[model samples]
Target: MQSLLRWGTERGAKHSCLQVMQDNAPALRLYEKLGYKEVYSYWYRIRPMST
Candidate 1:
């Protein structure tokens, strides 16, 4: 991940972003450790399922 970000920076990239599920604990922790922060929230609409 660091390498990828560095590569982008080398090419003049200004910012980076990614999406992860709210319930993803481990990934969230890792990203936080890497200096990421929550910028926004979103939801996915789904149809009701028949029982």
Candidate 2:
């Protein structure tokens, strides 16, 4: 992941973005260890239609 971010920066990327589920504590920890911070968060909602 770090290598990919570096490659993107080399190609002119100013920032890197990624998404992980709120329940994914391990992955979140990894990203945080790599200098990533949470900028925003969101959730999905769904409904069923009557037949």
By lDDT, the best candidate is 1
Task: Give the per-residue lDDT of model 1 (tens digit) for 1-51.
Answer: 889999999999989998999999999998898799999997899999999
The residue pairs found clashing in candidate 2 are none
Tens-place lDDT digits, model 2, residues 1-51: 888988999999998888999999999999999999999998888788889
Candidate 1, residue 38: Cα displacement in angstroms equals 0.4
Give the alpha-carbon lDDT of every model.
Answer: 0.93, 0.92
Candidate 2 vs. true structure, TM-score: 0.83
TM-score, every prediction: 0.83, 0.83
